[model samples]
Target chain A: MTVVATDETGRATPVVSGYGPSFAEQQPPRNERRSPRRLPRGLRIALGAILPLLLLAAWQVATAFVPAYRLPSPASVVLAGVDLAQRGLLGVHVGISVQRVLLGFAIGAAVGLVLGALIGLSRWADVLLSPTISAFRAVPSLAWVPLIVLYIGLQENGKVAIIAIGALFPVFTTVAGALRHVDRHLVEAGRAFGLRGVSLLAQVQLPAVVPAVVSGLRLALAQSWLFLVAAELLGSSMGLGFLLTDSQYNGRLDRLFLTIILLAVFGKATDAVLGVGERALLKRWT
Target chain B: MTSTTALPVSFRGVGRAFGTARVLRDVDLDVAAGEIVAILGPSGCGKSTLLRSVSGLDAPSEGAVSIAGTAVGPVDQRCAVAFQEPRLLPWRSVEANVALGLPHGTAKEPGRRRVAELLELTGLADAARRRPREISGGMAQRASLARALAREPGVLVLDEPFGALDALTRLRMQDLLLDVHAAVPTTVILVTHDVDEALVLADHVVLLGTDGDLPGATVRRVVRVPGARPRDRGAPELVDLRAELLAGLGVPAHHTAPSTAQLSHQETA
Candidate 1:
């Protein structure tokens, strides 16, 4: 056990693998392989549609048990939708609401990305700004209506600002948190490959935070819709929110029910689209 | 077209501590150009810290480490490392992951060719577009090695690069590593707890330990592996050497004496 040897007598012999050589040339399996348990396209579509049809049946049955004026039947709601569409009001209101949400969301997400990067990358920015933003975040989005109207009047700018404000916090919190806690080994790998400063941040840190940031965007998108309703009720004359308020005020229960269903459908549709896009973007990582 | 001038790595009175717990203390070792040195020690012996110091991932608290006579910083571009975890970017394809190892400002054509060369060498050319989660552990590790080699470093540091693989995969990776080293000669410092791995791959083995009542881990013994790179796995000398290494790591070998018979039985598994 105590025998100490040196290279003086340990003559070098060229090392060769005991496995000899590649007996046959090996090839890696193709990258086009799909998941083994995938269901057929038609079956998948059928499976996805079953629950919604059941929910629609339940809604129709519930209308039979409730008062007609309070809870409109699905048939009556559809008739009201047809009436509004015949008058060309449905398209105008829905289009206006959709535009506001998209514009507000774009602005909010851009601001959040910049602010989150600053806070996440620099200690000084986090210490100086995070506390104040957190305090403001605690206030409900509706609470700012009076102040907003007072300063800016009941206009498109004020409504869009409300939606932006509602959407901002989630994106900011997630991006900063994700960047701060990225895997240490990944960072080390980046450094080993000679990445530093801005290149490291752009190539490694940003990509690592993408999954979390996207989830945050989804949450912000849903919040924007909620805020849009409140903002429109406070000030606007044309939007899905306006139709809901107008119908409720005039006791037009069928129109009210139609507007509510339309909002729900729009929200669900947008969420589904976002989910699909996210899956496509992160197919490799997930 | 990177130079293959094998860099000599030297540590002089090197020490490292986290707050107050000193891990490595007053260590001194030199690995010659193109030689493979394995750092072997028990769980708390700071073998990984020693490797990290050389790669500049972790700075030494005292003394200095130099490669080719140049002192290293916290991020040394002259050396590359492969870790126990493959640590591939989940967002990147295998080919892109390998390409990431190219130094900044490297022209596009050369980098692309180097990545393709590495993928071919590592047997990953066909799985080039596959993502990390889509591959097996062995494939991921092979990609990691390719990424490290894409840097064309003068020194390669591997911190238990095959520690996570199954036994069969580990054996294959060892053979693959030998083939890689032969094809592109570079100084290698491999850290491992397995005595067999150290003996099989290294030209010299450095056993780190706390000499009774010592404050931190230091080089307790430096054993020059007898024979060449592809030494017979069941050689009598290697069997004795394995037992010696186990004893050096404080494993009691009472029931199993170092012999050719024991080596064969161990290898069969």
Candidate 2:
């Protein structure tokens, strides 16, 4: 409450709030200032399909000009693909492959996540099981093919088990890493907010690990495809992989090429689905 | 300790040491019903430790911490805490994030209703559809505050809630907090390093500083804040009180004299 009379005009100077003038906060960084973006309605869908269309066009052009024996053109592949489809061979093959992958992938992911969580959650668990997991990771997916068939045989169960073993480790490792790496500050904050016990894990801890889990699932999906193909190659009466092997043995280059194209399309299609699911679930997150 | 019924919370002779580093020693605090007590101290002075003790995140090495007539151990719905950062579940929508504090389905209907009411109170109703990442820091923090409020608890603990915000936003938040205090009047314990923030927001400003011999520092003085809600900073007594707090905060003597430019700027803005 001091009023000093030290002004040049011999008037009193009033003491006021020390806080400086609040200017119109300057416009923020240009990139930070960008307006929200949206793809024009239906444009996203159209744009997504464009690359495939172009690729298919190029494949058709190549096949039309080149020898059937070398490239076997898109038209011939489609004809082969359709011919295989009508004979119930394609459907049966696709069904067996899909079944093998889904069955193996589901079991593997479940076991992997639970086991990984146990290891991640406890130092003792990590000490005991961590080495075992790392050792198994070094063993290639195909290496399990002979052992799995020897133990479980050429039955569906055997193939499924092999795929599961192949897919499981990556999912497990990633989930563990995700859970381990999730910010501890967040967990502590959850504790402070009166969320203890089961609620704490469900509300706070579990969520922190989800993005990583989704990423793991994406990887596992890829492994499932790889495992399926490998399993079918080792021994299978059906599946695209079996058909591919069967066609190559018979010198049906067109059918073999057709299966490769089918495999690529299917792999991409599955990846697209996973990407969509991930986006939908994570939209609210960040 | 004998008059425990009058105070909702009390920390008695509490002390904590981690490894060789002692964070707090022989500290005691009491929060009566419907009062705002702010702890102001430098970083690492153990104000946060004390706050954590009150919530039972860390147990005291020596004595006891009691909340709502119960001893601290596991956390419960009786007390809610907000940190400087908004610790919202990123997977949830703004509305769902607020609702998560409500017990499972106890939050189902009431949670939805409260989310709306609370969002409106926090001026975040329009952002209900957005994700945590889709919002500004202030808005995300607003959602966090709303989430904490969902439990309708008797005790609210805040650790430098607005410390991360810009000055203008912090000012607005301070006013909003005062308004919230007026409406709900819960017993609030706010921790801050800024002396003016403590003065403006607390009913009692507890100064915790390192001049004490204890590792976590000790509560050296507790100043009783006077007057009603929405106190005018321009009032003569308030000006003096601010000067005293600024002195405590080590504001330079030259800068201690209020700048005339600020007053003129405030008028124009």
Q: Compute the DockQ of candidate 1.
A: 0.26
Local distance difference test, each candidate? 0.82, 0.72
The RMSD of every model to the true structure, in order and in angstroms, is 6.7, 8.6
True contacts kept of each: 0.29, 0.25
Q: Over the stretch A1-286, how does candidate 2's per-residue lDDT look in tens digits?
A: 2221122111111111211222113212223424469677599899989998999899888877887777777777778889988987888888888888889999999998998788877779989988988888888878878887889997889989988987798789998887777788788767766667687778777778887888898899888888888888887898988988999888788899887877888877887898888877665454
Report candidate 2's fraction of native contacts: 0.25
Q: What does candidate 1's lDDT look like per residue over B25-116, in tens digits?
A: 99999999999999998887899999999999889999999998999877787889999888898889999999998867889998998898
**lDDT of candidate 1 over A1-286, digit per residue (tens):** 3222222111121112322232112222323346668889999999999998998899899988999888888899899999999999999999999999988888888888888888888899989998988888788767888898899876999888888887887888888888888898898888878888898898789999888888889988998999899889986899999998899899999999888889999998888888887877777454
The sequence of per-residue lDDT tens digits that candidate 2 reaches over residues B41-133 is 657778888887776667778889887678976664566777888877667778887876554447356667767877777777877887666
Residue A223 accuracy (lDDT) in model 1? 88
Q: Using Cα atoms with residue i matched to residue i, what is each candidate's TM-score against the true structure? A: 0.89, 0.82
Docking class of 2: incorrect
Q: What is the fnat of candidate 1?
A: 0.29
lDDT value for model 1:
0.82
State how far residue B62 of model 1 sits from its true place (Å): 0.3
